[model samples]
Target: MAVIKAEAYGHGMLRVAESLAPRVDALAVSCLDEAAALREAGHHQPILALQGFKDERDLRAASQLDVAVTVHEDSQLRLLAATRLHRPVRVWLKLDTGMGRLGFAPSRAAELVAALTSDPNVTAVPGLMTHLACADAPERPENAAQLARFEAATRHLPGERSLANSAAILALPDAHADWVRPGIMLYGGSPLADQSAAGLGLRPVMTLSTRLIAIHALAPGEAVGYGATWRSERPTRVGVAAIGYADGYPRHAPNGTPVLVRGQRVPLIGRVSMDMITLDLTDLETVQVGDVVTLWGEGLPVDEVAAAARTISYDLLCRVHDRVQVVTG
Candidate 1:
């Protein structure tokens, strides 16, 4: 399963899904709405709803569309049992294992399995599933404990089991059960903290690129942008790129954040504003306005930008605004 939720982690749902549909066995989204959108866009492949239905209406839609939902709560099962639909729905029984966020208690798995199997409204043998909370940190004992719990709970269960997220798929080979769900890994983002995308044999699927719109030659002691947070230490040629927080660039990305200007790396020297960022192009003498600048793709890693912004690649990728144009190569 390729996790395409959060607009395929902000890479664009329809775009990614259209390209990946034939290649992937299934595409998973955050909710029924995303799946619906994909279906409306003519993507007829299997789509798994990670959080499942919010109500019977959603349940009804899932039944009609044959969208698979993750049933993690007792209420969800009850909702499924109560919902009247023309066809049985496909479902994944989420085991809590060690992740406190979702899934039934391990002790409650047998009960859920029994109830779900007995219910005629849902598939008798649903896929068994679990989410890894610390798969990115391979050294964490949580991964082992959770895997053990999942294995112990589902040993007797009769269904396909899927427990590997991108991290588990890359790092914990043992955790790759019947199906592996690759999310960040599909977009060339590193699931391991100690690894780079290229190091892991992953390439960025989406490259965010923009152009510089203006330039400024600042004298020593001259400050730039909101709050005058940073001043020129010496003679500086500050160039403003036509991208900013409103463009889904981090507003809090501190000075010295790396941005590629004309394939030359330069330090971001001011607060990222609503529609622009100041770059100290002092090192490059031949650059000018209208030059292309890569915010976090191509030459620079989104993770590096996120680290400087005190955030993560996931946040940066998903937070991209809807107005930005996306073209998949």
Candidate 2:
């Protein structure tokens, strides 16, 4: 089962999960609130809480809600050990392979599993899990190195193991284990370097779009946007989009970044502002007010947009401005 954590990487969790429910065995989230929200919305699919509980109350709520918790540390284990619940909790043990973010050390996973499984409150002890650091870069040896370490650490463990994330599922064939947790891939983001989800026949679940608020014609030497960083070298037709850094459009996107206006690629002009961006639509013949512009979707590849913003597609997808109304298609 693959989990769609953090609103399916900010692509609207409930809607994304609902669409994926038929294809995925289960869904995973970051907290109790998210799990509860999904349950209330009538999602019967199993939901795994990756962060686990912070206190007894949370643990009790999780037990009542029947959410699976990823046991990442001994402290969380201690809390679980102390708590008396109405029902036993299912747990997926997270192992810290090389990602320094979370999970138990590989050397101590067996001990932790022993402690967790012995507890009567613990229902399921699905053994061993680790996150890949560079599965997207197939040329990088880190993927194999991490997989080797994880396999070596769990070789003696007598239970199921999971190591494949989105990148692993696509790039490293050997990393696939008991269950593959593909997050971004389900939402149509490519974990590979040369291919996109679209190229792989996956549908894009989210399409970020905005309207043209204004249109202006700039002659040679006319400046555009904040910092006046972009000056027209020739007569240019500039269109302003009702999206900016505040709405999660990257501020670092330089001049000449491509934005799709009526399926035409227009070069961005000047600095990205708080609520708008200026695009040079010089060659686009029929752009007007309220023209739909796609910052990154369908007509424009997200990886290309991310490259223009000097960031990664993950950050762009995750940081979409909260103000933008999400429409499920």
Candidate 3:
């Protein structure tokens, strides 16, 4: 089962999910509303609510829709216990396993499982699951440590288990249980610093692009952008792109970070403002307005872009603004 949570990591949940529907056994989402939207869109795939029910009404609705709830908290368990649904609710028990986020403690996991299983309203306990904390850094011993802890917590449980997220699915063979939840890899982002999804045969799913709105010829002393952060050392041609921080483009991209224009690499020249970024296009002639400028994807890797921006590809990919039309190819 693959979880299309958070708008499929900000890469159009519906499009991503629909593309993967044939291969995925089921879909997992963050809440009931997302599940309902998918259902309305003619997606009949089993939807697992990762956060579980928000209230009694949500529990009833989930029961009616056959959405499985991830029992992550005691309050949710209680809510499930109190709901008078016509059918039993299926659930996945979450084990904390050192993430310190959701899920019950290792020692307490069995008890919670027993509690949920014993309830008449609960129909089935399909699996035990945990999120990897450091699977991206394969050399880090913490991955093994977390796996050991998870194993210990789930050893006596009879149901199937899910411990491999995208990183674990690619790197940790032992961590691959009955099911795998891959996120970043599906969008062509590298989960490991040393490896890219392309090396593992995955394609990038989103390509952020815009047009070059203007070109400027500048003298040596001429500056570009709001802060005048970059000045030409010699005669230069600057290309202004119709994208900026407002469109979730990273504002922290320092001067000289690469931006692709007409298959040529142009270094950014100045501060990225709310609506624009200036790039040094001096050597590249034949530039004009309406030329395609890719922010990241294809020739430019999002990971490299994020590195230049001093952030992660996940943030950059997910933060794209509403003004930018998202087209899935």
Candidate 4:
């Protein structure tokens, strides 16, 4: 399943879903609203609500929409028991398995399984699933420990199983089980610190770009942007891009983070502001106003910018602003 939550990681859910619907077996969203949007857009693939559900209304809507729900807590289970749906619903019972987030304790797996098995509102056997906490760092012992617990907990249970996210899908084949949920991987973002998306054979789905609107020639000591964070070291040339923090370009990205200009690499030279960012164009030849600048994607990897900003690729991908126009290829 392709994880299309957070507006398909801010690549635009409906657009990405439309592009991917014919290719994937199913799609996963963080909530019912996203799934509903896909259904309303005429997507026919099965949809899974990864965050489970909200209330009785959401539950009923999910059932009528034929969307699967991930039931992780006793409260959600109770809600399922109390609400009468027009038709049987599909479910994935989440196990804690050491994530320390959602999911019931592994010890209670059998009880939940029995409840789900006995509920007339449920259809077929509930699929077994759990999330990996740190599959990206393959050296970490946590991944192995979680897998062992998940295997032991579900040993006697009979149902399809799933335990891999993007990281696990690449690093751990044993946890593939019956279903594999690929999120960041689908967008071509590297989940591991030591790996690159190109090395993993993934293609970027989104490329954020804009054009330079201004150019400045400054002598040494001339400063750039807010707080005068960067000072020209020579007879420096600077290019200002129309893109900024307001467009989901992270403000936390420090001076010297890379930006691609005219297909050549240059360094971002100042603090990112609400409506603009400054790039040190001293090395690029004759960069001009209206020249295209790429923030991330294609020649410039989102992971590289994310690393310079002290964040993960997921954060950058998930926070793209709604004002920006996005279109499918």
User: In candidate 3, what residue range of length 10 has the lowest lDDT sum?
Assistant: 196-205
Of the two candidates 2 and 4, the one with more favorable TM-score, higher being better, is 4
TM-score of 2: 0.94
- What is the clash count of model 4? 0
10 residues in a row with least lDDT, candidate 4: 320-329
Model 4: lDDT of residue 85? 92
Instruction: Spell out the clash pairs found in candidate 1.
Output: none
Model 4 spans > 4 angstroms off: none
The sequence of per-residue lDDT tens digits that candidate 2 reaches over residues 52-167 is 88788879988999998888877888888788899998888888888888888888867877888889889856657888887888778888788888887778777787889888
Which sequence of candidate numbers ranks them by TM-score, best first? 1, 4, 3, 2
Candidate 4 local lDDT, residue 275: 86
lDDT, candidate 3, at 301 = 86
Among all windows of 10 consecutive residues in model 2, the one with the lowest summed lDDT is 197-206
The per-residue C-alpha lDDT of model 1 at residue 134 equals 97
Clashes of each: 0, 2, 0, 0
* lDDT values, one for every candidate: 0.89, 0.84, 0.85, 0.90
Model 1, residue 49: distance off in Å is: 0.4
Query: What are the clashing pairs of model 3?
Result: none
For model 3, the stretches where C-alpha displacement exceeds 4 angstroms are none
